[model samples]
Target: MQTASRRFDLSVQYACNKEGLPSRPQFRGWARAALEGGGQVTIRLVEAEEGQELNREYRGKDYATNVLSFPYDTEPRVFGDLVICPDVVAREAAEQGKSLEAHYAHLVVHGMLHLQGWDHEEDDSAEAMEQREREILASLGYPDPYA
Candidate 1:
């Protein structure tokens, strides 16, 4: 398969104490699977505090989510930023009985899809978005995350 020539900027902002999470290469793999052409994206790996703060500030939710997408208003090729909470992701993986790596891959793909204009606000939209996610994840050697 031909990989797209894209540029992704991953910024890991640790607001909480954690270590040994997946690196930028792993995230780039997921982003490439979702987006095409040459463009940029920022991936911020934050802690619960910052994640919760951002969620509350922007999304009106007081809790930290696994991943939050902040797509920039630019060319469609130049996606945007994705803030990922490692603590939340780990907790969710343990609670959901999923491997950390697999969960991380799923969330990255999900966030990238959001940047690509995929939303899950409606049932049909969710189905289509999730199908795309599954296909992307499967290509990356991961099982269906929603299964």
Candidate 2:
């Protein structure tokens, strides 16, 4: 079996009104745990407007989502961008009764997995993907998100 790689360049930019979000190191750790490749990824924290625009343009949705991933399918392993909305994250955390940090970690990993071409359009795929996410998050000391 081929062992997963642990090489990635991570960049984080905050464009939202919130302050004191998690650092780049935290996001890098999450990304490394999610994907199996040597690559670089840019994680941007943006407002609802930008997030909504991106979602609408890319996904045909008119609202800002919690996270969005853009993967580069080129050689040299440069993964594309992951845009996260803190506002949505906070709301989801509250609704789900999870810590903000934990939810943030989960979303970051989820987005990274998307960049690696993982999807949950079907039930089986979602289960497998979510199980992988649970394992990875657990290894990072987080509780099972689906539990």
Candidate 3:
């Protein structure tokens, strides 16, 4: 059931509890949907500690975020690494009353979108990004993460 429109390879590394994490195929689906199978992606699932450290180091934020995107090259095609914190993701999902799977899917797509130059730092950009996210998630049979 997992496939991509073009060449897609998802390299996944887990530094957290393996349970409840999506499979490689699932990630491939998300990445493919986000980039339309444009390029390669690497996703690393991390614990809260590492997530927090990375956030602080890279983003100047001391708290752990649900996901962070690092785009390496995007001219010819989208290529990047995404770091996802399962602890944060699970907490956010539970707090928001969303399914873990759906939240993860949303984050995967969100991260991929970021890699593709999508931004939400401003109101207009955020709205556009959210709309794209809703549409993409909908395509994947997931509820709107913003809704």
- Candidate 3: tens digits of C-alpha lDDT, residues 51-134: 999999999999999999999988667789999999999999999999999999999989999998999999999999999999
CA lDDT scores, all candidates in order: 0.83, 0.86, 0.90
lDDT string for model 1 (28-47, tens) is 78777877565578888887
The 10 consecutive residues of candidate 1 with the worst lDDT sum are: 1-10
Give the per-residue lDDT of model 2 (tens digit) for 5-116. Answer: 4456778888876476888788888888886767778899998899999999999999999999898862456468999999889899999999999999999889887887
Q: After superposition, how far is residue 78 of candidate 2 from its true place, in Å?
A: 4.9
Q: What is the lDDT of residue 146 in candidate 2?
A: 90
Q: In model 2, what lDDT does residue 89 have?
A: 91
Clashes of each: 0, 0, 0
| Rank ordering of all candidates by TM-score, starting from the highest | 3, 2, 1
Query: TM-score of predicted model 1?
Result: 0.88
Where model 2 places Cα greater than 4 Å from the true spot, the runs are: 1-6, 74-78
> Candidate 3 — what's its lDDT?
0.90
Q: Give residue 111's lDDT in candidate 3 (0 to 100).
A: 95
Error of 2 at 99 (Å): 0.1
